[model samples]
Target: MIKQTIAATAIATASAAVSAAPLTLEVFNPGEAAIFPVASVLVKGQQDAVLIDAQFSRGEAQKLVQQIKASGKRLTTVYVSHGDPDFYFGLDVIKAAFPDAKIIATPGTIAAMEKKAAAKVAYWGPILKQHAPQSIVMPQALQGDTIKLEGESLKIEGLTGATPDRTFVWIPAIKAVAGGVVLFNGLHVWTADTQTVESRKQWLSTLDRIAALKPATVVPGHFAPGVAMTPDSIAYTADYLRKFETAISQSADSAALIAAMKTAYPAAGLESALAISAKVAKGEMKW
Candidate 1:
């Protein structure tokens, strides 16, 4: 009986080893000219892979599609974190490349997309001009809180604060977290939706939840190339939110607020995000 048990255990161990495939995480940063450094991470297994976010605009998405193809892995899934146009606008490009890949997002995210799809398209149309996608490709509603690939499964946690709805993906095997738009590494986060004090507080609470994950590596939605996506991404975002709130309270005018923030984060380009936040704060623009 003891010999039989030992033989069974060895067989199981061997099977597990054969099924385990090495996974690699790579970030594709769409550098300058992009309002922010939108990062798309490719979580590649030996046979298949998953993409974190589609990208912000036409050019970025085109570059990302090429990067994915270069990876030489079958793309099975593209998980969108939120309804934000930047994350999904380039989805069509990816779909064209991997015809079988399913774009999935939470129901709430889909709703938000439906709510803002037209508005976002109008907003970006003039900016992107001919580079814009002819039409948006909405994501299919994710069935559950996890994405199951062949030999691996990624846990998804729906979160709010950064946006009306955002999803974070946790990969246990790699001890990594794809934080979507909830975290920003070395970039000024979009505060247009959180102009009020209450909204900013909620944003802080959301950051706390992500921090609790203790991810060894974090893939922030917007991050500069070569920047390490560690737990510091969460800290940086939290600190920026607090500073933005303080700047709002202390600055005498919109220009003053923008100046103060720029002075604080000189290297953090993309003044467009700050302009949007200022417009929203002054009641000049919708939240």
Candidate 2:
């Protein structure tokens, strides 16, 4: 039994000028259960904007499209943070709303997206029903690590977490990092695709690298609705991963691991990730 809160909370705020195209990030948190809270951000310039990571499900995507349109900013591009279904599945709605908006991703991300298309459709379609994307919308291969958006350079970098080739957008001007699956603020960290201890360690290293950049703000892949992504959010995530690693070593079995984890972090919302990770650890599940 998966319980959820699919509520959308909108946040409109401005940041200091990074360049002539000072960005105002408007985040929409669709508090959906089973599916974690997805942060769909509209990075608005003075006259245009770039969307980062489409939300999951058709209804969620449609709502996001409406919000972007309502902002009156000409959407120029949509950059998905990773290959995960939650990140890119709503591209259909985005394309429908902003036909001229170019969708872009890293070369590795593009390849991963192509590989996972079938599995995603099969797994998500039944659950999401009409809300799931009717077909895959692939992003164009990013020519270089950086893209110029309204005179500001948005740097695209790969950081592995939920999946390899996970992309993060760094705006040097504003010192803001648009973290994909690599960061989770006030949300359950997804571990279904992380299959090994080495991989988890690498993910931690990736997080550390992002932290070193010392962004004034970080927009995580999943976050509490309307709440700002702060440095504390990064700390919270780092602590959770450490605890999860320790719990894996101390627990006797999957059930014990989950029970202990629940007891240790009763307030954490996404229990599904715990269950899936535990099963994967015990060789009882496959990602």
Per-residue CA lDDT of model 1 for 14-83, tens digit only, reads 1001112356787776565465346677888887889888877777788788778887889999988878
Per-model C-alpha lDDT, please? 0.73, 0.74
Clashes of 2: 2
Q: Could you tell me the TM-score of candidate 1? A: 0.85
Of candidate 2, the 10-residue stretch with the lowest lDDT total is: 10-19
Q: What is the lDDT of residue 281 in candidate 1?
A: 71
lDDT of 2 at 125: 88
Clashing pairs in 1: none
Q: Give the alpha carbon lDDT tens digit for every residue of 1-287 in model 2.
A: 12233333322222122232377787765664325347777888888989888877788788788788888999999988788778888999899889999998877788888998788789778988988898789999877677777898888865334444876788887888888787875555677677688888877877787888898878777655544666666776788788878888888888987887788777665667778777777677776
